[model samples]
Target: MVKKILIVCIGNICRSPTAENLMRDALNHADIEVASAGLAALVDSPIEPTAQAVLEEQGHLPSAHKAVQLTSQTVNRADLILVMEKRHVTGVLGIAPEARGKVFLLGKWQEDREISDPYRQGKPAFVHAYALIEEAVHAWAQRLVG
Candidate 1:
């Protein structure tokens, strides 16, 4: 029933997009589509280079992602929306209060873990975030694909 999934973070260039691409690879479900958007998006931007590099190191060829902003319409379109942190949940609900039921933390299974932003940080930070995202994505994939 979850045909569309949206991942959200502060900026689409980092965590959310990483999770989006990783989920797309992990899910590989024909009926399901995974995408990412930012609470305050760097619209029309590509994935941050460091984040892209971390993904590449793990053999994931990052998609040609153009950052998008979270909107009520986008929120309504998704059967499920996953965010990086608690504030993101607030941000999404502010746009579409009716979506409270569908929005959840990306780390819902990992003790409700929160993924931190690595933008302007460094490769090490991006690497750390990627590991967390990858773990969470696999957990969701198992449930969704099962």
Candidate 2:
């Protein structure tokens, strides 16, 4: 049983937070738990405003999102870890080498794609990132739950 999921990105503000919320919404009734963290987090920053707005448009709330740094403890706790890009997976493995097989691109199931970061980009980039997250999370939820 895949009980715990961890979503990862460069910063917790944009990609990972959105993926976390989308997974939470999709797996609402499942026994799994979902959370997100950053490769290089801001520590105390809230989710980016653009990310929050994009999630809201999808009827998901990101108000509780808080930036967290990826750590060994979190890596050990998660049964699965979905990362925004291949570089994120590489970076995370450098920190927690034991998380080899369990870490993968968020778009791995769909043509082994990578979700690009929209960090300082404008609204359009944020929208694109959000759409990718939503699609990946939905597919992940379906496969894990069913």
Candidate 3:
């Protein structure tokens, strides 16, 4: 059973944090742990407001998620790693080559799509990203804990 999941993106303040929370809520299994990180994080910043608003719209209030940087330790701790894009795979593996088998695109089961970041683009971009993230997270939840 996968005990720990890590979501990764460019900045921890947007897509990844959103994915992390959504996955956690979707799974809602006590034994699982969900977290997120950025290859190049904003470091201690809060989640983007647009992203937060979209999450609330979906009935899941955003948590106090502070940006965390991706490190070898965090990568190693993850039983599974879900990244937002293809290039992110390179970044995670560069941190820990042994993670290759465990790292996967979050949208791998959703036709291998990429979840784009919608930082300052306002509500529409955030909603679009949230839809993709919600689908991917739900797909993963079914696979991981169903």
Candidate 4:
């Protein structure tokens, strides 16, 4: 029954945006709207180049993402908010205390694993993160659709 989903990470230019686009592609549920934001956003920054390249290599079209800061209003709008790390969940709660029930780790089903930041770590790091995100996205998609 989740009508809207928000993916979150620290910067929005890496993990969150990657997960956002992948989830959008995987879900295919017309009623579910997916978006992303950063706890401490870069504000107007695009997806990190290495991250974008990893996504493209995996056949996921990178969206025209502009980094956005997470706000209470954004949290309220999402029925579900998937974050990249445990700290991000805490950060989101700090923004919207009432969002406690809606927030979760993107890797919730994958042993609660956290997707690490790959900002300046180059393509290898981005590739590793991409695999994790893709796996998590599929897990979520199955649960969401089933």
Which residue runs does candidate 4 get wrong by more than 4 Å? none
TM-score of 3: 0.97
Q: Which ten residues in a row have the lowest lDDT in candidate 1?
A: 27-36
What's the TM-score of every candidate structure? Answer: 0.98, 0.97, 0.97, 0.97
Cα lDDT of model 3 overall?
Answer: 0.92
**Over the stretch 1-146, how does candidate 3's per-residue lDDT look in tens digits?**
79999999988998999999899888775689999999999999999888888888889977799999999999999999999999999999999999989999999998989988788888889999999998999899988877
Give the best candidate by TM-score. 1
Candidate 4's displacement at residue 10, Å, is 0.6
Tens digits of per-residue lDDT, candidate 4, 14-71, equal 9999999999998775669999999999999999988888899888888899999999
Question: The CA-based lDDT of model 4 is what?
Answer: 0.92
Worst 10 residues of 2 by lDDT: 57-66
Off by over 4 Å in 1: none
**lDDT tens digits, residue span 1-146, model 1:** 89999999987999999999999999875579998899999999999998988899999988899999999999999999999999899999999999989999999999999999999988899999999999999999998988
Q: What is the C-alpha RMSD of each candidate to the true structure, in Å?
A: 0.7, 0.8, 0.8, 0.8
Model 3 backbone overlap count: 0
Candidate 2 TM-score to native: 0.97
Model 2, backbone clash pairs (residues 3+ apart or across chains), number = 0
